[model samples]
Target: MSRNQQIWLGELIRCWKALAPADDNTRKTLAGLVGFAWQPPVDQREPEATPAPEPELPPPVAPSAAPPQPMTQKPKEPPPNPQASELPRVAIEEEAQLQAAEWDSVEVLNPPQPHNRQYNNLLPPLFRPLWSRTIVTTLASRRLPIGFVDAERLVSTMAAARPVERIPRQPRWTTMKGVQLLLDKTPGMAPFLSDQAALAALFDDCVGGEALERLHFFDSPLRGVVIGGKKAAYRPPQPGVPVVAVTDLGLGAPESHFNRAAPGEWLSLVQLLAARDSTLTILLPWPAAAADPGLQRCTAIVEWDRSTSATLVRRLLERICG
Candidate 1:
């Protein structure tokens, strides 16, 4: 190559070396220009090789110096499965087709709503017909008839002055006392919300709103209860008024419940109900087995269920009243 050509080529190669990526063509071109030999950088020429890990040596075993023995025959591998080709193959994936629902098979019923007249009540069928009369029988007080004429009083008035103390007339159990419903609004009584509503309706129907009263309490009334939306001591209606109290008597409470009523606490309440001028009847949700024995003796406990018939309530009330 000419001297000028060599100089230009040398300059171009140096420029390429500084700016361009590594290429064999540049080295070749530079070699032809002035016998230029390309020498790679020291780092590219020799690289530090990572040592391969040595294979774990077998545990030291004593070498046996036995004489050479005849070679044993090698066991052949098992033949390929003959039935593999004959097996039925299933599709790897199938395109699923959605079918229309068989809505005709199902009967869609538009049931009568709760507010509808066709709606059947949870109250016992036999109860509504018999409870008003049955309760009257249970709670009626023995008093002389209003228009009763006393012969002794008439004779006393005819003979002496002022009728010598009004003649005592034979008492008749005919007067129907008013009623009050004491409802337990505690956690234990939550399940009986519907039952309470049914009972309230039943009582309200039996005795008009004027005669029917509702009171609220927690687990027990020993600590008092809610009266007129304010905390007040729980007392039944006035003398001759019957009170029907719906309570679980702490039987529904958990074992570790803090407000669970003790047998003595229940006894005190029962004594108050049965002994006081206000008569109380418990509509217990639990079975008779868990009932307090003292409570059983004090007042009539009627299980609030389909099993509790009018006859059963009448018998239970008669047992307490008689």
Candidate 2:
């Protein structure tokens, strides 16, 4: 073949080797395309056959007459450091001794006396009784305004009002005489009657003039005054009313003495009273406009601001000189 033809054939063989499928039929087709006879390369000569050697057998020995003896046990080795073994024991003993010494050195202290008798004896004879009475009175009068002497009378009025009982609804507006008649029927309304003008002013300041105009008076079964709409209606008690203080508003904190979670109990009894009595008046510290939406349902809300020093002095003088 010419050099150019040889180069062409070389390129063709390489392309066939790269692109063709590697198989016997593919090799035959490649040979036919190249115009060469197809045949597998012949083996030069048969390799000499060699047989594998058999595995060597181990030698057999005769059995011994007696069983083999157990190996002698090795002696237990001692700890690497002898002192380390005793360290823990020594430390424990020292700690115990130190604790014993400390206990022994500690001086016995006498219990303190509950009260110093010498100091107590120095006080005046009337001091103990007066102090005890003051403490008890202060503790017992939770939520009650200080210097309010008419609380009991007010409570009585609330009790006589029978606020929980249903009454005939009246017109929104009524005269002072109508109020007086209602108060007269309820035994404990003397406090409200003491200062009608002041009461009216108080109502005017609390609810707007519209509420004051529509006001109807009712006697509270607990000796207090209940002020609500003339047409307000109360539901009847389930069977009876539980004993409770009329001043209870049922808004006390859970931890307060006035909390009403428990019925017929200290503060809880007040909650029962509020639930059973619809005529109870709640004293709100803020103006009606500032009250929360939940509190808007209240029939009346009274706002009381602290009196100034001048006002207090003037009132006191008027009372004293009068």
Candidate 3:
């Protein structure tokens, strides 16, 4: 198509002719036609350079003084080719570095805090109040850290002789004397029953050595029942133990109470107290008659009769200990 392409093609034809098994004359003719000139047999042929044509001159310069014309020259060429594919290598590296820096500079937003939750709406409003009323307000009312057991002495004695501290007697429900003894012996019974030592310390100031000496369990000889806060006990009293206090402590009582309510109001106040308070002993009204279900609502029932002040104290104690 172009002059260079035609020349290259002619050179290729000359080469092909030399390699062919044609006659020497034919090969010589082909070389001449392709513009390949041969030298004498004794000497090798040398390539000759063709002189370029002179550039055209400008018109005659004026006589007046003027600046000289600048020389016209070809532009400087780049260095020899490396490879086209390698051109983007540097750009790729720079782009990756920029992305990493941008990611590092970005800051993360904090998550939102959760909202406070309330009781289910299906439950009656009375359930919450009853539950709150039953929970223990003092450590003296619980079973753990008995008022009778001296922690320091107990720990020391246990370390000296045995590997574990000896369990001390914790007074539970029994006869009227047992109830009086529990009240008289440990005025801080509500606070002392908690497992937390810090909470028990609150009642430690109220309970004395005298109350500690007389502390005893009902029926069972075992000392000090561990009660409340994660680990707790809901032991039903034995046949011999008298009903000093009554409570709807069993699950069956609450289930029955739940059945009595209307279809929409399924929860029982007594059950709500047991679930939430974990301390108050809920007293259910005795059955109205022989065939009545009220009597079955509670395992034990005790009649409380005292002066206004005494009644208040008894109620307070019941709230704390139950």
Candidate 4:
């Protein structure tokens, strides 16, 4: 049958299985009518036991002359066809090339070694706590260039490495809270919270009268109430007055959340936020695993594993020392 016909027939069988009753006679009759047989499943039956074969007796030993001379290395055998050496050097080279190509095509099951320093150094120490060693090593092997390009590659590699697992919600929340606490502690900084009402009040307090008219909020798929209008037009935050934008793309549940927004939409959202020149603090549940393209646009890509107080303290120490 044609491929399409086969597919249709398979689908029909699946539909039948779903709709049909659990009567064995009905199933057997229907299966026979469809040119198929309903045999009892092999797994349901106990396998037959087989008798073990008897061990074979060793061959009878033959008598040897001179009480068996001391063993010596076997003489090297001559090539089967000495004339084969007369073949063209080009032919020999071609054979060697084919062998090398076969080896190259073989997949290496072992994990790759961590070698690329450029990729490793691209990530900041503060953010290193978020990624596992395996993830880092995988990214480094790709030798991705610095900047958003590396982010794209990292996301793709992460997705390929762990295709089924979704980014956990708790880590994203924890990282968001940690980053917020860190920024809040910093003097003279006004953070843009996810709470729209609170953010509106904060904007009024910070930007005030005339600036507030230029500033407006727009709802975002991944982020809520993105500060747009004239405020978004600014390239960089003014000194001593930093606008911190906080967004948490919480655990992408119900596949539709991501499906509704094309990967490009997420990328554009990130780019737009990045262009605003605000201190953009994004909390995303495992973007790499999701292969979310927006991940590549961010300045920092930190893994938010379940971090302990000791780990946090160690990171802080490293940050201070550096």
| Candidate number with greatest TM-score | 1
Q: Rank by lDDT, highest first.
A: 1, 4, 2, 3
Please give, for residues 1-322, the per-residue lDDT of candidate 4 as tens digits: 4464454446436745465634557655554554444432212222334664565876767675334532332345455586765876776644433332222122222222232122223323322433433322221111112223344545766878856344322111011111111111111111222232333333343334333322222223332222432324323333212223322332333434442334564456445544543223332324434445445334233333334233443332223222
Candidate with more favorable, higher lDDT: 1 or 4: 1
Backbone collisions counted per model: 0, 20, 24, 1
Q: Each candidate: what lDDT?
A: 0.59, 0.33, 0.31, 0.34
- Which digits, one per residue and each the tens of the lDDT, describe model 2 over residues 1-112? 4454455456545755476534547755664555433443222233434664564766665677554542333345455685755666766544433332221222222223
Q: After superposition, how far is residue 126 of candidate 4 from its true place, in Å?
A: 17
TM-score of each: 0.50, 0.17, 0.17, 0.22
- The Cα RMSD in angstroms, rounded to one decimal, for candidate 2 relative to the true structure is 41.7
Decreasing TM-score order of the candidates = 1, 4, 3, 2
Worst 10 residues of 4 by lDDT: 172-181
lDDT of 1 by residue, 1-322 (tens): 5565456555644754454423446544543344343332212112324665656877776568554442332235357478844755332111100011111222222333333222135644423444534543343332334445666657767677664555545445443555777888877887777667766665665565677778888877777889878999876567666677788988787677787767787667656766655556788888866787877887788776556665677667666766
Kindly indicate the candidate among 2 and 4 with the higher lDDT: 4
